[model samples]
Target: MEAGKHDRGRSGASIPGRFVAEAGLTVPRTVLIVSPYFPPSNLACVHRARHLANHLPAAGWTPIILCVDDRFYEQDPDPLLGSLVSPELEIVRVPALHARMTRRFGIGDLSLRAWSALSSRAADLLSARRIDAVLITGSPFYPMLMSRWIEPKFGVPVVLDFQDPWVSAWGADQKPLSKAGLSHQLALRLEGPALRKARFVTSVSTRQNEELAARHSWLDASRMAALPIGGDPGDLDLLRAMPDIRRSRLDPAMINLSYVGTALPRSHGLFRVLFKGLAEMRARQPGLAARLRLHFIGTSNQANDSETFSILPLAEAEGVADLVAEIPRRLAYAEALGLMARSHGLLLVGSDEAHYTASKIYPALLTKRPYLSLFHRLSSAHALLAAAGGGIHFSFTDANGLAGLPQDIAAGLERLALDPASLGQPRQDHLEPFSARAIAGSYAAIFDGLR
Candidate 1:
């Protein structure tokens, strides 16, 4: 139970290691993981990756990470991801290639899109190393394209860990270079033969599993599985112990709703609607508006600047601009969870990019914090929260048929406040199952089935 000892000798009835032990899968099923963003990357996807990689060792599957060195990514390197690894788990950070490090955020075929060769070269390292299955986490689905080529040539099985549904799911939200677009079409066309040939496909949610199954009708469809992001029991305990935002709690009866991600542009962004709705609600319900305060817990850097998202002027216009507070990324994770423990609920904004997975919701579950989701109706994050057995969900289209907008949202908050089961009550089923050990166990099952 120290800093890195999340998995002591196996606990009973868990998924990740238990499944592996039951199947008699022993050390070194050998998985080579390709993640463009790894530890020190600090993006939320690595939480799940680190969790899965750390736990599967008990089942005897060795996970090796192949990631772009953080020096190459747009943000400063966060050394945290590497800390999540247990000594027994093998890991590798591929050195920076010419364009890969320089072209972190470029959207189209310009920089990030054209950097496939960089990943291709890095993937070749797998040949010298021992690897049984190729595992890939995507969203720079660009690198996984390299896996398609490398796995086939190297004779390794492939498992695509989809943090978000790629291609079609993004297409549903009208993303640039979509499955309908020529460039994305090219990636998919080249990827199809490689994709169909893979042993298994997995995801963080059923919404995405279904999206993949629909697009790849020729594949067995059942190969897709859901290994959701789970809360670390350690993080849960640590967060409950974290100091309350003393000033935030001092405000009389204020509802501290939290959002824990980077800001993005206005097109499909939920912060825009959230602020506007709060403004409208203020005009109608003075008490609720005045009682609400939003504490955002991720750095708003030059990269996710609010000016580009048009949040500044809109926020000012709504007279609720000051409600947005920024916290550093390093302290953000645990502090945000701590705030969720003390607050009435959490709030999430959709990114301009669709198929973007919001890691905010999972931690909310951990804290037993109910949340109000203001996302596009079809968003995987929204779908998961609505059906995940707790919380209130509202979408741009009233997609879940939750009545009217500001009125619907205001009423929803009132309902959450009134429900004896929701307010300040702990989550009976906290998200421990999504633990890395649990996830690695999930993969071991698929591995045993396929192997």
Candidate 2:
């Protein structure tokens, strides 16, 4: 029922009823959204973020976003995506120094100038504003920690969006800043205490949530929500029905197994194993290499940055020659999904060492295309695909004690080659919940509650 109706109550004409109705409609709480990446910066960073800020007011809370200006990020800002934000809410953009610092230093690590300036700016912003609540996105977790500095100054409730498993995210062979460890002490100094004081904590997935919950017991599980990274409906609309590249005459009879997203240096060895397996395919079926298109969607630091910047040479040495094509980030997603639908199969790689989840796995589901995943056997991707009954997976580490890495990939490819026809059909039931609007509504609900 609509509020503020002229209802007949026991007290005739219901004057008090009108007053009660007026009292029921409370003013929307102004929420401050702290994020480093907002689109059309087009960084694959925040799928959940845009949804939250754009949908929040619809759910009742007023979103006041404080983020790095898109122009500051070394990329063109999409006015179209920015238009999604309601003019009713305030969006505060501060030009950041990180991107420039990254261009100078070759990586997006903390710069003393950038770090000090932002930390100070964040403190100043908090001090000047009256925010009912603050939702901080981690990455530049530094900005989130600003809440700690200003929380005492202004008693505002804060939410820490630790979107990924931090601290534990040290790359393999990247020695801990310290062992016994002053660096461990210092690194934790940045993330620890601020998160400890947070009113609530959230991560993108249940696995990430468990990792956080294991450390901070005060994080209410009820408050925890799996904010699955989402694809734009516009992105999804790009999903097109195309003939299997392996089946089509234009592509020729070749197995096109595509992997979208970065094949980081640490993870390159895993793909190397697959490449080695392809070598086997080459040895047995000589023409397989010509037909085999192992498309790597998204830029590599090697391609995008360059460095000790190894992996490509190593991949070539292993014999997956001319196989690795590093496509630009812009064409990776929706186009890749369509490619997945038409390719013989999609290959998913995750860390077998850690209980990691690949964000690319979800988009593959939308394709109705079968994916062959290699990583931890019990991964969520494997489970989701198994439930949908359209994907296959095995642990590369477990099968051959990591010995048959490439050979295993080759063997798996051969197996997939056996049945080029996949049970390709959209899992509409599964896709329904993941629709951008649905996810956006849940975000709206979270924002509504904040009000």
Residue pairs whose backbone atoms clash in candidate 2: 273-405, 273-406, 277-406, 277-410
Q: What lDDT score is found at residue 226 in candidate 1?
A: 73
lDDT, candidate 2, 268-373, per-residue tens = 6566666677778778876666667766655351223423323456568876667655454433233445666677777887765444667677667666566667
* Candidate 2 worst ten-residue window by lDDT: 12-21
Q: After aligning candidate 1 to the native by TM-score, how far in Å is the CA of 421 from where it should be?
A: 7.7
Question: How would you encode candidate 1's per-residue C-alpha lDDT over 67-111 as one tens digit per residue?
Answer: 655555555554333444555554454444445534454343212
Error of 2 at 141 (Å): 1.7
How displaced is residue 216 in candidate 1, in Å? 3.5
Q: What is the Cα-based lDDT of residue 384 in candidate 2?
A: 55
Each candidate's number of clashing pairs is 9, 4
How many residue-pair clashes does candidate 1 contain?
A: 9
